[model samples]
Target: MKDLLNRRRLWVGGKGGVGKTSIAAALAVLAARRGKRVLVASTDPAHSLGDVFASELDDTPRRLLPGLDAMEIDPEREVEAHLSRVTAQMRRYAAPAMMDELERQMRLSRQSPGTQEAALLERLSRLMVDDDLPYDLVLFDTAPTGHTLRLLSLPEAMAAWTDGLLAHSRKSERLGKVLAHLTPGSRRDLASPFEEEGGDANHDPRTRDIAETLLARRRLFHQARRRIQDPEHNGFLFVLTPERLPILETARAVSSLEDAAIPVAATLVNRVLPEEADGAFLASRRAQEQSYLSRIDETFAHLPRPRVPWLPTDIQGVDALERLASCLEQAGL
Candidate 1:
């Protein structure tokens, strides 16, 4: 497997109970220790980056260690901001009487499925495109497998949607011009009926603005898609335990990601039991783990499988993450 730490963008995803966030944090700390500036952001609604870093975090990046920073995206807050921006843009193009109805529809749309994911993607795009940050690496601690997959797949869908919108906008503009030229006194009022009074009916600036915005968004999504699919720049790390369900899910996720042209750089088989355990229960569990471990080795034979030992206690805070990082280093990850 390629060195995931060498990538500019890394997305860590796995099953819910798997130690995805812990591994992501560990990687960030490890990179920072090697004198690299790193920004780790959590896209999971149920955040644990703050817990792992043992520090408060918000939407904006906050410095945790010398060269490490962390941030937790609030989906609710992002959704609200997304709605506000959309509504504001709509108001500029919509007629006064339609404002109430548009606002109502916008509010309703907020409750619809995928709104949060869309908002999160918008924020993720901003982070990826923003060049002002001095960080050498940006690691995304994503939600569970399914949600993260959907989020990664969104750019293609969004690009198609934007293309349709642009096509419609251009068609409408051309039709408006034709009607203005055909009608006796309509040349001066070529503006759309949706436009506010005194707005140019024939060449409405609002329409151009909307088209420009869609074009900009399309370009942004295109850039994000290219960045993710570029193996030399970005990597996807799927974390799974030595168990049935997580293994299956990880396999499916890897297949789906490859189908989407996004590279799955490596897999982390976390929480393997030690061979020196003495108790019968531990022995039995270890036996089962070994069986699963063999299966994992056979299944992901082509990918790098870095096994992490199960710690004596729950992993939290910087110390535990450092220990995990050390283990990862020892495993040659």
Candidate 2:
């Protein structure tokens, strides 16, 4: 359980409306208060960290506690930014005649199903590899289980896609090279993106922009996947309550992560009933929860299961978070 305090990265996720945000916030508060520089970020499109912290938050990291910062990763903004970058990159190679079609294609890509997730994955990869990042620990408040599973599976899929493109490009280049011996201007030299832009566009007619872009992206996804699978540095923490649906969903999610070789650190069972509660109605709910708690123990017997007592009021602001943090610390996590 103490391993939670030292991980370089922790991704908190589970079924929606499970109070995962609050749990993530509490962990951040605990870590930051103990002198660890922490960044608690929300990757879900519906922003609620601001509400939990009782402070306004945006894309930028805003200082919360002395050692803690918070931000919301906006998928919409990332998608638009990704589109703009690609548009600009394509503009460098596109001829005047193709500009209208290029614009139409880019516009249509905005409404595509996987565009949002792809854009978000790029942002996440950048964050994961950022050399200038200052936080000792980063906690990601992720979306619901299904969306998160898809997001986690993307790096491999994208890398494979890039590999196919590279293979096709190589085949085309070989053919082009063979034709170049028989005809003038039949092939171009591949230019590295790091090289300074200068001279005529025809300087190296073989400038393989497709090859360079695809290769670079493949490396990025590969690096992202490596870090994501490292158990020593990363933890995939699932937050759930003592209930039937969350338990079943978590079981499936854990199995999926195991299949993907992602680390499942532990489960934080929030809103466990307290012993001091009175009344038959409350007792009945507690009895049912007891059975579910037993089920949770049996299900996740291999991992640490920390139970957090239910609060009379909703957890909010630094004060409420501090209280929750204390409970979390006492839970030995």
Candidate 3:
């Protein structure tokens, strides 16, 4: 876990309601205290980073402490922005006759499945590939295990999708050239499907734009994917409690990430009962927790597993998060 701090990016994920946000916040604070400028962004739509920091947060980064910054991405806004950008670009190159239909399709596509995720991934890719980011480290407080896994897997999927689009565009360009040579008439007869009539069929700007856009998106996805899979540059931390369902789900999540070539840096077991706690109910719960703790050790023995004792009260505000950071430091994380 200590080595994980050396990485430039960290992604924290786990079962919902497992304090993943709190753990991510603690890590951000810890890194900031260590003199690293850290930006912790919440990718979960049901964001609680603002609640944890006791401050209002939005899409823009907000300073939470001297060197710590936080933000909660608004997925709906990202989707709208993404569609708007696409619409604007298409309007510039699309045939005038297609404008009404294109606008209608774009509006309808906003509610399509995976549209929100695609928009979110575009935002994430921009953040990861931005060379001028001010922060030294970026921590992602991700959604629950399944959603985060899908999010992390998106670059590859999108790259494949973009590759297909580029291939088809290139094929269309070749077909247009062949048609222009075979047919003797105005260039309008040989215009590619994407181009306006009477335009240069051999070098259609619209086809070039489509190909360029897809290729550029593919390049960005590749860049982000490389950075995410590089162990020296990125860390994936799984936060879970010592319980049956969370433990099982985390194991599966770790397996899925590893299969995607993304390394799981460490496992954090939160809300463990303290040994000093007394009472029949508490003692029994501790015994149950011990069993699950042993299972966690056995399941993830190859990775660092840091256990955080259950706090007497809910952790909120900077001070409590700082205390949790201290606990993490003491555990050598």
Candidate 4:
């Protein structure tokens, strides 16, 4: 588990409400305590990073300790910002008559099903490729298993989509060249809505501009995927409780991540009943948990499994987080 600390990025994900946030926070605190500069950012729309750190945090990182910072991404805001960027770019080249129609379509897109995810992917890609990122490690406290899998897969999906656009762009360029060769200087009649008033119809600049834009975005997604899967620079840590559902969910999540080529480095088996707790009910609970624990070990036989004993109190602020971090250290995470 300690090997994960050497990587530049870590993604902590699991079924929701399984102490996922606490586990992520603990790991971040643990790394920070070791003098590594760390940024713990939440990708969950319903964020608990503020509660875990006992500090208010938004999209921008806020200092939580000497070597640690925390942030919670606002998905809605990212979506709005993303659409605005695309709209601005279109307005720069689109015909004036198309502006109203474009704005109307943009408004409709705000309600589109995948717009939020696409926007979040764009934001995440920027974070991944930013050369000015200051942290030694950036830990993503991700949404639950299902959402995380989709998010990780986006770099590939968007890249493919960009490739398709580029293919079309190339095809259009070929068609234009063929038309120009056949008609000579008579190509002005072929001008469409894309041409500016004074633009040369012999050579439409829109296709070239669109191709350049798509290529730049393609590079962004490519770099993001490259960083995400590079074993030496990244690792994905999964946190799960010793329960049937979380165990099964984790297995599926790990499988999806493996299919996507993201490095699944380790697993943290959180909230194992402590030996000191004594009662008939507690014993029965521990007995059930023992079976699950055995199942987890067997199912995820290849992963480095660390067991964190359940804590008696809530983990908030630096002191409580330190206790959890110590538990992580003792558990060999």
- lDDT (tens digit, per residue) of candidate 4 on 18-78: 9889988988999999999999999999999889888889999998889999999999999
- Model 3, poorest ten-residue lDDT window? 193-202
Give the C-alpha miss distance for residue 169 in model 1, angstroms: 2.8
Q: Which of 2 and 4 is ahead in TM-score?
A: 4
TM-score result, candidate 1: 0.91
Off by over 4 Å in 1: 173-203
Pairs clashing in candidate 1?
Answer: 190-201, 190-202, 191-201, 191-202
Top-TM-score structure, candidate number:
3
The lDDT values for all models are 0.87, 0.87, 0.89, 0.87
Worst 10 residues of 4 by lDDT: 193-202
- TM for every model, in the order presented, reads 0.91, 0.90, 0.92, 0.91
**What shift in Å separates residue 213 of candidate 3 from its native position after superposition?**
0.7
* Deviation (Å) of 71 in candidate 1: 0.3
Better lDDT candidate (1, 3): 3
lDDT, candidate 3, 42-140, per-residue tens: 999999999999999999999889988999999999999988888998999779999999999998998998898888988898898886999899999
Number of backbone collisions per candidate, in order?
4, 3, 0, 0
Error of 3 at 155 (Å): 1.6
Candidate 3 Cα misplacement greater than 4 A, ranges: 174-202
Q: Count steric clashes of candidate 1.
A: 4
